[model samples]
Target: MTTRPPGAAAPATAPPTSGQTPEQAALRPGLKNRHLSMIAIGGVIGAGLFVGSASGIAAAGPGILLSYALVGALVVFVMRMLGEMAAANPSSGSFSAYADRALGRWAGFSIGWLYWFFWVVVLAVEATAGAKILEGWIPAVPQWGWALIVMLVLTITNLASVGSFGEFEFWFAGIKVVAITGFIVLGGLAIFGVLPGSDHAATGFDNLTSHGGFLPNGPGAILTGILLVVFSFMGSEIVTLAAGESPNARQAVAKATRSVIWRVGVFYVGSILVVVSLLPWNDPSIAKKGSYVAALDSIGIPHAGQIMNFIVLTAVLSCLNSGLYTASRMAFSLGQRGDAPRSLVRTNSRGVPQPAILASVAFGFIAVGFNYLWPDTVFQFLLNSSGAVALFVWLVICFSQLRMRGIILRENPEKLVVRMWLFPYLTWATIGMISFVLLYMLTDDSKGGGRVQVLLSVLVAALVVAISLVRERIRRNATQDALASR
Candidate 1:
């Protein structure tokens, strides 16, 4: 029923490099389509897939496969909607900007700050995770020391140039893609008794049914499994943000968006299928040894644990790399929009948002120190506090797309290069699904501390919303006062 107001201009189709106005061209076009493509392929494949799937398997048994499929479908739907908006209005702020245009300044300000909080928290969490791997490999440095080193390294990479961040992520994500693809190929061969000299004749589709049927923990566990794996899909939207820096942002976003659903669906569901297929869901080895390593060890892969550890290390670094980049770009966007300090909008000679990068990393370092000193008190609260923010971000995207679609249809239908399937119907379905997930989180208190996490996230979100409203009022008052004086 709603429509774009009269005189509202249709979204422009400016190539990032050839766009008019010196202000628009200030952001360098360092990222190529290949970088965007790789980033998309690799973004969904996180360290959590390798390390965290064990908990989901333990929770849901072989039925965990269904959980992954369900979550993958949800992500595909959400991304389709997000791509439709991002492809039309590419910006460093991404969904935040969309929320601003579609909803209001309040929605955009609250979601932007909350999203930035999520990634900054992620920076600390991932830094600690990478530190553990390094400390395990070479005990020369202590855990805290390793954490500091990893944070510093990635911070430098981001500050050096956006191109540096792109290059680093390209290789990091490449290893993950190759590793997962190899696992799927080799594991499938082993299941079919085609792998040479393999003891995998026992490994087949039977593993899925042999232990307590397909639903070992019953159908309810699938919901629990969803909570476990859903967070792993958080980084999938990084490609949309990276698209803003590309020479051809609209095409880049469209290409990345179109390819992401199939790639992520296959990579996540395919690899998980291989894992549960190779070993029984209740295999003792899976818990004692991590999921991927146990699956590799099942077929007698040499140094499986070491190889998996290296791969996980790469994933952690990739996440940290992209986390810093995403957080800073978001800060830069917020600064430009007046939600954050104006200094954050200033770029170095290389067109790098240095202040934004430093500010984001500074918070990350403080979090690292909290982990070292007061982990149980402060860091634990911080962890649980931001836990459900990914769901919140997804919810905002769903609503933003709903309003954005109406605007695009009325203003310029041609800008909708990537369309959400089924329009408003599926869009509403996705929104309902996300709301169900959040409510599910509130009631579920299995193992991952779901109830406490959701409660804390709610409190944090409320605080941010309040701050945004208060800031808006203050600005409104100031504007009125200025007009009265004039």
Candidate 2:
């Protein structure tokens, strides 16, 4: 563990490069404080919150608030643990790097690749989603053409420099934040019978009970709703990864960790509260128009669908942009640690990992091709195969933090800027909750294909772990042979 004196002045632009490997030193700290701030704020608001929450609302009724809260709490804990490690030692690899030192080489190798796989797959998903919206707006261009354009534009944004990625994300996330905040405010007004020209019949807290009543589908649906909504929280950890490129990495990480609770509460749970309050959970429009759009349309907002389409498009682009940046950085980190090809560590004069960026996007473009070529079979398999990765990632973070806490405390107590509350007990509880979620996923075949997703994800994770073990053994044998020669 590397430790700076308690009161030493922190670097203004990048993490200390002292004793850094060539690959680690190559990354530039071009992300400003404002960029990191918005990334942290925007990281909590994924497109899933806007487009995917309707089914959850339907499944749990108004009690879906509880589902979001439960998952939000889970994310809070995981980020806390991750923040502790990241604050102590900022790394582009983030949790994967912590896993390497705390668990073993295999732990880091498996999870890093798994996380990289998750994001590149996300690139295809977001690109296709954006393409659908673009095709709707401009009928002349084909969906595939829109996808190609979106990918190329963002790829260029990332390739230009890390600062450009941050600037793009800052505005993309800013638009989403403003849009959702506006929805919540307008919806809240209509619910209170204060908004003029509002004639929607279903409004107020009574909607929670007037219909089938909260939790009308029964208490089990809350768990079912968890399956629907958990993945929406996937990008919340992107801030920790982005922190590595910030000058004030440790302080930025600590602040982001502290703010996650409210961010999740206000953006996710708060927005859904307005949605359910503005209309009954079971309203036909809720399912047809989506939660946000339905709430806006209920209040007599014009062109609700198109308004949401624009917001969703912005979110998809933000996600695609962050997805490419994240996947490439993780690959660059993997290369630094010898878990990937040495070529991945190669950077251009601007300190951009061109090879890593190209490698990630190459896979993304291929995934987009699969989506078009085999929408039903191959693409569906790809989606399900990566579905449970978020849970897998949080689970690994819980385990890694359990070991990393002790390691940090022993090696350098001063570096513990962000501490996980209640130590081992809360960590253990988080582990239990995550494990239960995974186990529960195996039993349900709800809207998200929980059972199939979990089973396929497990199969894919096992394959990666197997590869990691084989690589470790081969490397171990090589080291032993060198010792014998010596």
Candidate 3:
């Protein structure tokens, strides 16, 4: 069951099969190796890493480094499982397709729609954040106007051609990779007092331990930091999804999964180590300015705040670009699986799923409007409702892979190009860890939004499950009626 590479001439609608439909043939394989490589490299570094880390440091002190390491390891394990299944069978559906085969229609439909909801919400969040920055810089266009403008531009790019989206993401992600890598190099040199003209205030490992010790707030704070920083890692799985559109999807997914370990280690843990070592965790500058900017200032970089603002803006745009692409693909897959409107599976002359793209962006724009109309009440509910969805998606991937691996071995052993480490054991461990995180979210309300997010996400998941079951029942009843009539 090899997937037909995109850009190849799609055959006229084939006779629909019982298990799968015929509409999975139109997406173009316009994503190049460079686009995928940069997306993998830059996906882990998000706007959260730039602007959100200050709070994490304040919570866990220098020990926040350990929180990153813990979460980074969890992501690595999850991606390894996802890569194994993806290498065996790549689809625009990605994990949703696997869940359908391994679990059932309800599992696939529920998870697919949930994942789509997660990204659409992200589209609103990132757009609003980016708009504020653009408005601040230009001051001519208002924030709402900027949000509309940004969404419109990216939507056009996505509808134009898959390659255009790939090219835009290539440069957007490339800027982020360069910024973070430059920060790591410059910050590391400054920590050792080797960078010329660097600020001499508080350099070396002493900064890590000198300020009330490494676990300044206490060992318990690491869990708090974990909750704070884990959401930043949400987009790391985009590489596997993007790989489905590559020419050699199996090889691409395999390569990306293998490389993720070192990338996360270097870009995340290494960068944080430099930040903590270069300046004390309790530094007033870290709280006032972002951690990354404070690190830059410590190294005598002028206009550190303005420089970081540019990088953060780049990150927000990159996220919006990827989020739209992801949501549209999910919608297309769901339609092909008969869980969504069939129209969503239709593609344009350029092999782009124009209907799906528009549908996903329409919801995103609506969310942005709601954000403007009711910033504190209605919009905040929307934000919290989708907050814990990333964890839910990861948990499904873990379960899907577990079932998929056994079926692969029994049915098609040769297709196993990538395999999860420690097979069933680590697979089960990953599931347990994810469940623990969700349960922890339920018990902990101190984050101001944690409990509400978990409860609302559960409520959303339950609603999706109920809808899928009801739809299945209705279809089954209709089929039986036709048979009896015949």
Clashing pairs in 1: none
Task: List runs of model 3 lying over 4 Å from the truth.
Answer: 1-24
Separate clash counts for every candidate: 0, 1, 0
| TM-score for each candidate, following the candidate numbering | 0.95, 0.95, 0.95
Model 1: per-residue Cα lDDT over 313-367, one tens digit each? 9999999999999999999888878899999988888888899999999999998
Off by over 4 Å in 1: 1-24, 446-448
The TM-score between candidate 3 and the true structure equals 0.95
For candidate 3, the C-alpha RMSD (Å) to the true structure equals 3.3
Between candidates 1 and 3, the one scoring higher on lDDT is: 1
| lDDT tens per residue, model 2, 1-486 | 223467776544334653222224568878899999999999889999999999999889999999999999999999999999988888889989889888899999999999999999899999999999999999899999999999999999999999999999999999999998988888888888888788866456998888888889999999999988999999988988888777788889999999999999999999999998888888999999898888888889999999999999999999999999999999998998899998998878787889999999999999999999998899888899999999999999999999998998997799899999999999999999999999999898754488999999999999999999999999999999999999
Shift in Å, residue 77, candidate 3: 0.5
lDDT ranking of the models = 2, 1, 3
Quick one: how many clashes does candidate 1 have?
Answer: 0
Residue 5, model 1: Cα distance from true site in angstroms: 15
Per-residue CA lDDT of candidate 3, range 1-486, in tens? 123465665467542222122334467677888888888888877888888889999999999999999889999999999889888777788888888888889999999999999999889999999999999899999999999999999999999998898899999989988888899988877877788887555467998899899999999899888888999998888887777667767777888899989988998899899989988899899999889988888789999888988999999999999999999999999988899999998988887999999999999999998899998888888888898989988999999988999998997699898899998899899888888878877767754467889998899899999999999999999999999999
Candidate No. with top lDDT: 2
